[model samples]
Target: MFAPTINSLVRYYHTFKFSHLDAAIVFFSFFQNMNF
Candidate 1:
């Protein structure tokens, strides 16, 4: 039980981080496109 909870927390954290990174990448791409 303890191990499963820990794994879930780690998965949640990783997904959250990935989403933020993805958003930043999208925003950066938009700015670059606008400048061009």
Candidate 2:
């Protein structure tokens, strides 16, 4: 059940063509902003 959720997220990300680096940058910035 949990695995399918993760797989769907991965597929969605690929559908949008986000590179690993791009995703990392976005995640990092999101966390940084949330800390404020």
Candidate 3:
């Protein structure tokens, strides 16, 4: 169940044409702005 959820997210990301680096950058920026 958890694996499927992760796979679906990965598929959706690819379908939207986000590169691995793009995703990583967005993720890093998001966390960088977090207070905790």
* TM-score top scorer: 2
Model 2, 1-36: lDDT tens digits are 657755765676789888888878766765577689
Q: Select the stronger candidate by lDDT from 1 and 2.
A: 2
The digit string of per-residue lDDT tens for model 3 on 1-36 reads: 657755765776778889888878755765566646
CA lDDT of 30 in candidate 2?
A: 54
> Which residue pairs clash within candidate 3?
none
TM-score list, all predictions: 0.49, 0.55, 0.50
Ranking by TM-score: 2, 3, 1
Error of 1 at 6 (Å): 36
Candidate 1 lDDT tens digits, 9-32:
457657776577776675576557
Error (Å) of candidate 2 at residue 9 is 9.3
How accurate locally is residue 33 in candidate 1, as Cα lDDT from 0 to 100? 71
Model 2 segments more than 4 A misplaced: 1-15
